[model samples]
Target: MISSEYCRLMARYSTWQNTSLVNAADGLTNSDRWKDRGAFFQSIAATLNHIYWADALMLERLKGNGRPEETIKHSLASPSNWDDFKVLRTQRNEEIEEWAARLVDADLNGTVVWYPGDGSTRMERPTALCAVELFNHESHHRGQVHAMLTAAGAEPEPTDLSLVP
Candidate 1:
């Protein structure tokens, strides 16, 4: 199980890494950004969009809402435009941090239940695990974007958690 303090720390780390990622990626051309990189999400923009969508989805569930309307298939839906994407990306990052800011121990000690994008079946998990997974999911996709950025010759800042300051 995780604690509120852990979520807060991870949220800060997320903002730090995201700022670096966006700054570096801004230097790339549209074709370069959207070029198929053969990663899971296929390209930097798509992957980043998926990351943002995942954050929104997890945020709704964490806030006791429900699965987001946007599904995994449509994770890349919206703001293919860099400027708009940046705005929404920053918003989702801030939202994640804000949600983490309000977490209490009791909040993470319980369970969260929801269906996946397909609503295939009901899924239930410890709130603590979901809390941990939120950050985990971000890092997972961001790492893909990080690699894509680097391969395309963009320079994101160091991602070491200790460097989060």
Candidate 2:
């Protein structure tokens, strides 16, 4: 259902889109970014935090490098400030890119077992599926952030994957 090439493309696209969104948010004042816009996550900052949180969770599952407990802990907590968020976000993007660069067919075809962070049970699924999920998840939350950015009068760069350079 997925391939390394596909994963690589999506990874690059995800990084590109994320950078664009973060840059757009950079234009807003701290108060404006954190203001309650009545969105699902209540604010642009919260929504972006959620995306970063999920990215860390899924990346750990995919890469098996980070401690799940620690990743989940930080993700559940909001960044101390925008600078912290951007730093972490940039670091995670680089990690994702590195992982995608080294990915292989076998890696994508393999399965990963993990607790769904609910503490109720564990689930297993193909790495490819999880990889796709990561990209899909980012795009989903980014859509909300994009709307919020526009609503806040900040013009974000275009989001089309084909436009990535």
Candidate 3:
């Protein structure tokens, strides 16, 4: 079982990382930020959008609800531009931090059931495992964005967990 303290700490880390990345990315032009760099999600903007969508879904599931399904491609195209994304991303980062802050030790226990992007079957998994995945998933994609940002000559903050503040 994971403690709520872990959730709170991860939430803090997420906020620190998100702000650093968005700030760094703000230096790039729209075309530059949206250019496909052959990363897994194709571009910095699209990867950020994908993370935004999936994080919302995971948050809902953590609350025992399912979000409307959308294709991976749809998520990639979501908001379709950078300005809208930046606004919504700020809101989401706050929501995620709030949710994590509200958790208690028992909140991470038991299983959470939710449909995937396909929305065909209801799969169940331990809440602790899902909590881990929730933070890990964003970190995974953010790493891709960080690489793309740097390759585009945009400098994001260092990603060391110990450096979170």
lDDT of 3 by residue, 1-165 (tens): 689999989988988898889999999998887798999989988888888988887887888885435423345448776788889899989999999989999889999987776678888999999888989999999999999999999999999999988
RMSD of each: 2.2, 1.8, 2.5
What is each predicted model's overall lDDT from 0 to 1?
0.86, 0.87, 0.86
| Tens-digit lDDT track of model 1 for 1-165 | 678999999999999998898899999998888899999989998888888887887877888765655433465465689999999889888888998899888889888888776778788988899988989988988999999999999999998998789
lDDT of 2 by residue, 20-78 (tens): 98999999999999999999999999999999888888888888643475556745778
Q: After TM-score superposition, what is the CA distance of residue 85 in candidate 2 from its true location, in Å?
A: 1.1
Instruction: In candidate 3, list every pair of residues with a backbone clash.
Output: none
- Candidate 2 segments exceeding 4 Å error: 65-67, 70-75, 118-120
Q: Global lDDT for candidate 2?
A: 0.87
Between prediction 1 and prediction 2, which has the larger lDDT?
Answer: 2
Off by over 4 Å in 1: 70-76, 118-120
